[model samples]
Target: MPQIPSAEALRHARAALATETETIAKAGGRAPVTDPVITPFVRALRAGGFTIQTSASGCDALGTCPACQNRYLYTALRAGLAHAVCPHCRDAADRKAAVAGAARASAGPCPPDRVGWRGAAIAAPPA
Candidate 1:
C-alpha cells in the first residue's frame, strides 16, 4: 500500500536530496557568513525547496540585500563567488561620482574639503 514515484520524479527527488545535502555540507564547512549579505538568501534557501524558490521567486542571487547592500549571490556566500554592488547603491555611487567630476571640472584640481572626499590615502604626485 504505498505509491511509488515515477522515474522522472524519482530522479528529481534524488537530485534535490543530493543538492540539499551538498548545500548543507558546503555551508557548514566554511567559517560561516556573518555578512548581512547572506541573511535573506540563506533563509529562503533553507525554508523553501530550491526549485520552487527558483521558479517562483527567481534565483536568490538576483536579489539585493537591504543591510550591506551587496547583490546576494548563491544560497550561501561561497569563497569563489563574486557579487556586484546592489543596484540601488550603484546608482547612488554613480550620482556621487558625477557630482564630484562636475565639481572638479569647475573648481580646478584642489578642492577645499579634499580630505572629506577621501577615505584612503592617495599616492602623491611626482617629486
Candidate 2:
C-alpha cells in the first residue's frame, strides 16, 4: 500500500499551491506555474537577476537579457514563440547550433564497414 501524506503535510502542500497560484496571477499568467518550457526559463531569468514584467492579458512581457544586458520585448504572437527570450541571446544560440551542425556535417557519415562501431568511434578520415 502507498503511504498517504499526513494531515499537516497535506495542509502545507495546499498552502504552497495557493501561494504559487497567486504568484502566477501576479505575473500575468503568460505561463502557468508548472509550465514545462516557460516556468524553468522564467526561474532561471529571475535567478540571474532579470526582472520580467508582463501585460495584464498575459500575452506580452519585457525583460532584460543577462547575457548581453539588452532589454527585449517578448510577445507570444510575434514569432510563434511561447516564451520570452532575448533576441541577441537567441541569435547567439542559433549561430552556435549552426556551427555545431556544420561541424557534424563536415565530419560526414560513418562508413558502412563500421556498422558495429558507435558514431563517435567511426570518425571519417580527413580529406
Candidate 3:
C-alpha cells in the first residue's frame, strides 16, 4: 500500500513547485528542479521513515481513473469490456460475473447449419 501524503507535506510540495515554476517562467526556460523547499520536505519525511514516491508511467499515466479522476486507471484486457478501468472497478465487475454465473455464448456469430440433403435421390434408368 502507498502512504498518503499529509496536508502539510502536500502544501509544502505545492509551494515549492509553484516557486520553481515561477522562477523558470522569469528565466524563460524550463523549471529548474533545485527548489530548496523540496529537499527539506523530503528530508523531514525520510527522518520519519516515510517514502514519498509518485506514480510514474503505465496505464495510470495514459488514462484517467473513472472513479477517482486520477491517472491511476489502467487499460485492462478482459473478455467483454473493451475499455480502460481502474483495478477496483475491474474487481467489482469480476464479482458481478461470479454472482451472475458464466456468460452464455450468445452474442457472437452463430455456427453454420449442418449440411442437409439437397433433394431426394433421383433414380435414373441405365444409361
Worst 10 residues of 1 by lDDT: 92-101
* Candidate 1: Cα lDDT at 99: 22
On TM-score, the leading prediction is 3
Clashing pairs in 1: none
Q: CA lDDT of 116 in candidate 3? A: 11
Across 40-119, the per-residue lDDT of candidate 2 in tens digits comes to: 44444433333333333423245565577876523111111123355345421111111112212212342322211011
Q: Who wins the lDDT comparison?
A: 2
After TM-score superposition, the amount by which residue 113's alpha carbon in candidate 3 deviates from its true location, in angstroms, is: 55
Q: How close to the true structure is residue 93 of candidate 1, measured as C-alpha lDDT? A: 17
Looking at model 2, residue 101 earns an lDDT score of 23
Q: Candidate order by lDDT, highest to lowest? A: 2, 3, 1
The clash numbers for all candidates, in the given order, read 0, 0, 0
Instruction: Pull out the clashing pairs in model 3.
Output: none
Residue 26 CA error for candidate 2 (Å)? 27
